[model samples]
Target: MILVLEKASAWWDYAWLTFKNPSSSFVEITGYYIDRYASVGAFLRIAPNSSGTLGVQTHLLQKGQQYSVYVTIKGTQALEGPFKVQLPAAESEGT
Candidate 1:
């Protein structure tokens, strides 16, 4: 499986990054950030040519900015899951 975190800014960033899987099972991914709004990208698994993730990232989010994530299984197939994203909370008065 391939995982992608995108930061959608008009500025420069890594267009694509590839990962090689040394195992043969499903992978658990966490804390992924897609930071851009318009940029398009995907995670590609070459061995079985199965499962990928595609999304856009953005730097700014408004209240109710609407964030959604979907996964693609076997390239052409899509599966939806329980994905949620929240704005980073402000620092408290005390450390």
Candidate 2:
């Protein structure tokens, strides 16, 4: 399951949760930024666990810009999908 976190800023400040398949031995979550220019940012490993809450710091992003985060999960047994979240510039903090 995937959930889009609200009140996110350019720094990536938001809390999100990811579920790992019980049959899977490992799970990895990656984070990226999508700028208004339709540019893809570098992929960073935000979470490297099976199941847990990701407390992201939005400071990773730049001000006056928008971004979207996506994650891909692979289980050892079965079940795989992509999760994504969109961030708007209006939601960013004036820091």
Model 1 has an lDDT value of 0.36
lDDT of each: 0.36, 0.38
Mark the regions of model 1 whose C-alpha exceeds 4 Å error after superposition. 1-23, 26-39, 44-56, 63-66, 89-95
lDDT of 1 by residue, 2-90 (tens): 43333321212111223233446554332234433342344434343234332334335443343544434442343433244443332
lDDT of 2 by residue, 30-89 (tens): 443333323233322324333455444344455444344444333223222323334435
* lDDT for residue 94 in candidate 1, whole number 0-100: 21
Q: How many backbone clashes does candidate 1 have?
A: 15
**Model 1 TM-score on a 0 to 1 scale:** 0.32
- The collision pairs in model 2 are 11-58, 11-59, 12-58, 13-58
